[model samples]
Target: MAPTPDEQSRTRTLEGVLWMLGSGLSFVAVNGIVRHLGTELPAAQGAFIRFAFGVLFLLPMLVQLLRRGLPAGTLGLFGLRGAVHTAAVICWFYAMARIPVAEVTAIGYLNPVLVTLGAALFFGERLAFRRIAAILVALVGALIVLRPGLRDLAPGHLAQLGAAAFFAGSYLFARRLSDLAGAGAIVGMLSLSVTIGLLPFALLVWVPVGPVPLAWLALVAAFATLGHYCMTRAFASAPLAVTQPVTFLQLVWATLLGALVFSEGVDPFVLLGGAVIIGAISFITWRESVLRRQRSSAVIQNG
Candidate 1:
């Protein structure tokens, strides 16, 4: 007999959780590779090459997007996202080269918190008390990780924070564009725009990169693409609440990778901070899910 709707929903949620796991692993691998590359090349150059390779990988989609005319007035939005994302990418690369993988991963968690704030500020979303409390908790988590006075704040930490902010900006733009275009078009345009945006920075700090670095960057592009695809799959399969908590496992994986492979010391502060940030984000996601369900039920009841 065919599975019931409830059973099917459970199965899809499980599938989405698994997809989130895969997405986390793929991104962790990409981070490991970038860490391995170290400071062998300028961060701008590294970011540019990575996104440039990303463009090549996304060539077919780009071609398709070009063939199908873009939605009106979206060109500027894509360009803006690309510009913001380029900054994020560069800062991320710089931070990855210098910071412990776990720390970088932990700091990056601020993106969602910033995005929540951005939505309220820019999109007129209601900033409820719970959201305000969550945002404050997230800020505390970030402070725990940095411990500005206790430990000398490294440029890497600052860079990662900047990356998170810029990434949030990019996400906000993507959110706007999502209402106007398909995912494929948004992704393809973003990739193309980032490549173009990074061109001058990459050129400004051009250095001869060996073939090995080029190959590794190509692999980075592939894994990054895979991660995005898996994340998209996860979102399609289940609500964000089901998949969001699974991302905390990325900190665990990153910590293990750092300890085992990079021989980096495991910092308890980083782990604790990461947990706090993840918990806050998870709470927000859960609250949103509950609110959404309540709204739907009210609509059904009234109808």
Candidate 2:
């Protein structure tokens, strides 16, 4: 029997949650590799190589696009997204190099909150009171996690913060592109464009990479590509509001990885702050989803 709309929604949310869990695991693995590789590779080079090697995985997508001509002007948008995404990824690699995996993961959780503000500021979206209050809660959480005065700010922390912002920008563009392209196309553009964007910079400061490090970066690219594919599946299965909250699992996974693999001590404050931020974001997502459903029902009634 065909499921009712409510049942379908519930099923979709469940699928999204599972896909997000997969994405979290994939990203955690990537972070672990990036942390290890950071000791040997420059952040720029790691990022560039990740994308460059990632292109090999995305080859089928490239071939598909070539076989069927791309829509006019899409390449430019892809290029722009690639440039912005590369900046974020470089910062991420740098942060992973300097900070504990858990710390970087904690700071990274602020992406959705940043994306909300960016939408309001850059895209002129209306911000409701509840969303504004939720955002403030997230800000407080970020401060708690960072504890700027309590601990001297590390350059890696600052870089991770920038990474979160640029990641938000990349996400916004990816969301826009999703409307016009398939998941393969979006990922292909990102991999190809980011490689192109970083090539010149990589060429200037390039260092010889040993075989072991090269293999590590290849694994990073592989996991990252899988992570993105999972993310795309999650987003397609359910609304972002439903899936974004599940991504908080990355912090937990990162903390475990840091403790078990790197012998890094876990900070309670980071976990607490991440919890608060995730809680607030979850509420905001629920609120927005409710509003959307209500508006849809109202339109149905009026029609």
Query: Which has the greatest TM-score?
Result: 1
Off by over 4 Å in 1: none
Model 2, span 194-303: residue lDDT tens: 99988887788799988988888899988987897899799899987888778778999999999999999999999989988998888888888899999999999999
Q: What is the model-wide C-alpha lDDT for candidate 2?
A: 0.89
> Backbone collision count in every prediction?
0, 0
Cα TM-score of candidate 2: 0.92
In candidate 1, what residue range of length 10 has the lowest lDDT sum? 56-65
In order, the Cα lDDT scores of the candidates are 0.95, 0.89
Q: After superposition, how far is residue 225 of candidate 1 from its true place, in Å?
A: 0.5
Among these predictions, the greatest lDDT belongs to 1
Provide TM-scores for the models.
Answer: 0.98, 0.92
Query: How displaced is residue 60 in candidate 2, in Å?
Result: 2.0
Regions of model 2 farther than 4 Å from truth: 1-13, 238-242
